[model samples]
Target: MHKRSFILTCLSVVVIAAMLSGCAGTMVTPTQQNFKAPVVTLDSMEVAHAFGYWYFSKKVKPTKGKPDNVGAPLDLAFIFNIENPNEYAVKMENLKFTVAFEEFDLNTVASTDTMWIPAGKTNQVRVHAHFDVRQSLLSLLVTGGFQLKAKGTNAWAQLEKWWTGIPEYAVPVHVKAGAAVFKADGLTQVTTFKATFP
Candidate 1:
């Protein structure tokens, strides 16, 4: 009887070890080929703060040998939602997009802020864009001049309309040529997007 009991104990140990080995095999790590690109959407856009919306300074006094400058500042904040559909978490490495007022591309905004989105979950990111009247005027003249002329309007008039209309949601704002980089399990993906804001 003692010999029989010894044999049963050995068999039980072997069975337990086999079960553990099988469980370990089931716990496989996700590989690069298993990665999927995260979905990105424009959650909202806000005129966070705007001062001197209609105010323009010209021929300002020089300070510390700096040349005279003109400035009227506007700040906008864009919020986005990143959704990870994979079974593993994803890290957003960077995001960038062009800001367009109506049909004119005014500036390119970017964020290097990194965040990890959990598996089958979502995360939010906010990026800010700043615009100056003087720089915007130059951009319009150099890049969008022909587009403006075709529309039968001048640069200053268009700038004024944007400055006054954006805060009131009367003019449409666009996010164009957007690219966001995400990484997970040694895999990298670039996602592109375009959105319009009211």
Candidate 2:
């Protein structure tokens, strides 16, 4: 009888330990996931002339002065209008992107958002980009289209973790656009515009 009771108690303890381990495996934490911006339309405005002849005379035949190297850095801005078109609010983070110019890899850019838009709501986001004109003009003159690529964090996984009560890092963004040459001379040039997110 004593031997039998001892064996029964050991078995019970083993069963209880197994059950606790199973419960711990099921435990999860809740944390919000990253938001990904949909591929929206990218529209470009008219390409305005960056330089114009200022002073010149037809008097005694005079040789043209040095090329108007005023604007050396070109500024290009593109606006994207995004529509929420979804049911859930997207948390913006963990996004990565790259830009290609004239078939050459240039650089990667980062993005920032000032506000968040609720579901079925429309908002505006802005992206500002600048590049060296001397390096870009050759490409622009050859190819009219500038390549752009972007990527964002996975929202669903983040949502699942959040719902499960797990802590997660904030999402990040990646942006990139082809560069263009400037007509004038300048060290730094900037392009600023706004994108409407619906």
Candidate number achieving the greatest TM-score relative to the actual structure: 1
lDDT of 1 at 65: 61
Per-residue alpha-carbon lDDT of model 2 for 1-198, expressed as tens digits?
Answer: 999999999999999999999987774322222222333444532112222112222343446555442323423344544444334443333122344432343335556543344555654444544544434434443443333122232322222322222111122212344221111111222233222211
**lDDT agreement with native, every candidate:** 0.87, 0.37
Q: Which residue pairs overlap in candidate 1's backbone? A: none
lDDT of 2: 0.37
lDDT of 1: 0.87
The runs of at least 3 residues in candidate 2 whose Cα sits more than 4 Å from the true structure, single-residue gaps closed, are 1-39, 45-71, 94-96, 134-198
Each candidate structure's TM-score, on Cα atoms with residue i matched to residue i, is 0.81, 0.34
| True lDDT of residue 76, candidate 2 | 33
